[model samples]
Target: MYYEDPILKLEDFSLNIGNTKILKNLDLDIYPGEIILLYGPRNSGKSSLLRSFVHLNEELYNNVEGVGGIYFLGKSVFDLDRKYLRSQITYSDPTFVENLNFLTLKEILNLSLGLKLKDISKEYFSILEKLGISKIFSDLDNLKEYNSLKNWSIGEKISLITFISLARRPKVFIFDSILDHLDDFLLEDVKDILYRIKEDRTLIISTRNFSLFSDIAERVVFLDDGKISFAGKTESFIINYPK
Candidate 1:
């Protein structure tokens, strides 16, 4: 992925749902292989902005109206099929990944990779090793953890999203509510893994606290009251934002 042009671009984008406007004329450009951390307090429209990329807010709101456009790889995302758009621009929230609790490890991978368990077993197992979770999986075998997800750690569940993202290889990964559950140690490890996966993929992370991932994110964007309050390099943001 060369760095001449942005992989994703938003132009004067605005969103309206019934009686209220969620995003107001926001413009942004996301380059290839860039790690972007979007920060804002709750109800600041950070989630809505991310959702607009895949046109997800439309489904959630019946009176949705979008002004302006979002282009992905120079193509209008509006023109693409919903399913294909979602595949290319993967969106995951806290509740989204936690649903893996109902499915086994292999089952989750099967859905993401579109492969049969028998064929994908050995391959995905090696990926698990890279994540340093092979021991957990091996232990789970004894407990038949494959059949139940209740015993799974929250960080482990979140990793399944990362695992699937790695296997499927999407162009963009919009992760919302990722800073809440994971511990500092796991966050550090996940930061390394995220950098690996991001060699060819762009990341858009929604967080309330940017300091937690300040070291990992290359760029930072802040939204306030449905508008962009700040957009700049990570170092610049860190220096300027209130602690």
Candidate 2:
């Protein structure tokens, strides 16, 4: 397959928030069809880096310095239309929790497609059914009515939210600590989805959970205290930073 320019690129990017330097001259590029793992302990500036890429922190946006780039399919994310850029660079954090209240699986899927209020794909639900998750919403009414009034397991909630993410299939997908809360079985399913998406989109996952990335990620970058401590092949990362 002919390759395109970097789907997302960051070079010499640095951020200073409230007198604290969050990122120090970080450089990285993510090509299409690659899955990268960003692993580091809590408060290591992983979230800060994400904010910079997606333009989430308005206050910090002006303070960010460096000749870095954030792109979606060869177009600079900053240069592209904001709403259009958001459609391509989908960032899913723990805060996607609001999606949990979506009730039925179909409703959740519909909600995502409705985000841009774009055209609903006819085959979107078909993908869900193929992934063995369709049964979760076999009964749409009950699923939508499912409430926090009724306690659901973390595993179930994660599974539903993840399926919706896969359904969207953004060009640059970002996940922050998403799989840490999932069980092994569900984690495997999520991995399968990531692998399937590899042929078309780039996956950027940030998590402290290293084992999950050992087999899925081609490159591993370690972040420590707002700096890159290490970057290399996944196997080498495990051999050197064995938990």
Candidate 3:
């Protein structure tokens, strides 16, 4: 399905970190329910650009200076409350999963909704089954005993993080350099989950593994030295920037 309305817009967006320029004159529009792939080598500003959308927190904007503006659902991102913006536009990275070690899978799942374990709906269990993590749920007691994401495999960590993100049901989801960490099987599962959930929300992912998502993403935004070097359909990007 095609969405005509723009869900996010960047107007002459530029970012500078100390003496270095990260992004330059970026003007882009993101449509709702569209899957966008942001790809480039390291330091191309893919992560920085993704972080800009939820820059209400000082941690993201501390060392950076943005000249232009970023608008989400027609409002400037800077004007939105930090917590509100974070709830609306969720950002997930590998490190995000590491922090979940303190909480059990049930607690982590209910974290976003502020629901008690007993209060969690049956739908949550249904989602866990659909994601093929019913085994993990069944072993919830044992898994909780680990008490640290450090004990889990990379695939398990990513899967759990993806599940938590989906449970949030945010309008926009941002993933940073996460696809490269998964094995082929886990990658396929993650992609399947993304496909099912993306029908209602926008997905912006940054990864060096461009070919993995080439067929799934509607648009591809290639960054070079902090500026968008190419922005168009997935096929066009592959053709023009041939790996």
Regions more than 4 Å wrong, model 3: 1-3, 102-107, 143-148
- What total of clashing residue pairs does each candidate reach? 0, 2, 0
For each candidate, C-alpha RMSD in Å?
2.4, 3.9, 2.3
Residue 99 CA error for candidate 2 (Å)? 6.2
Candidate 1 lDDT (Cα, 0 to 1): 0.80
How far out, in Å, is residue 201 in model 2?
A: 1.0
Q: How far is candidate 2 from the true structure (C-alpha RMSD, Å)?
A: 3.9
Per-residue lDDT over 1-243 for candidate 1, one digit per residue giving the tens place of the 0 to 100 score: 344688899899998989899899989999988999999999999988898889888887799888998899899888988889888888888876568778876666667787654464776777766655666556546436554666777777776676676667789988887645677776777678777778788998899877787888998999999999999898998789885
TM-scores of all models? 0.90, 0.81, 0.90
Clashing pairs in 3: none
- The residue ranges of model 1 lying beyond 4 angstroms of the native Cα positions read 1-3, 121-123, 130-132
lDDT values for all models: 0.80, 0.70, 0.79
1-243 per-residue lDDT for model 3 (tens digits) = 444768899999998877678889999999888899999998898888888888832484557788887999999988889789889998987677667677665566556676554554678767666555656555458556544556776677777677667788899999887767888876777788788788779999899888888878999999988889998998887778888
The lowest-lDDT stretch of 10 consecutive residues in candidate 2 is 115-124
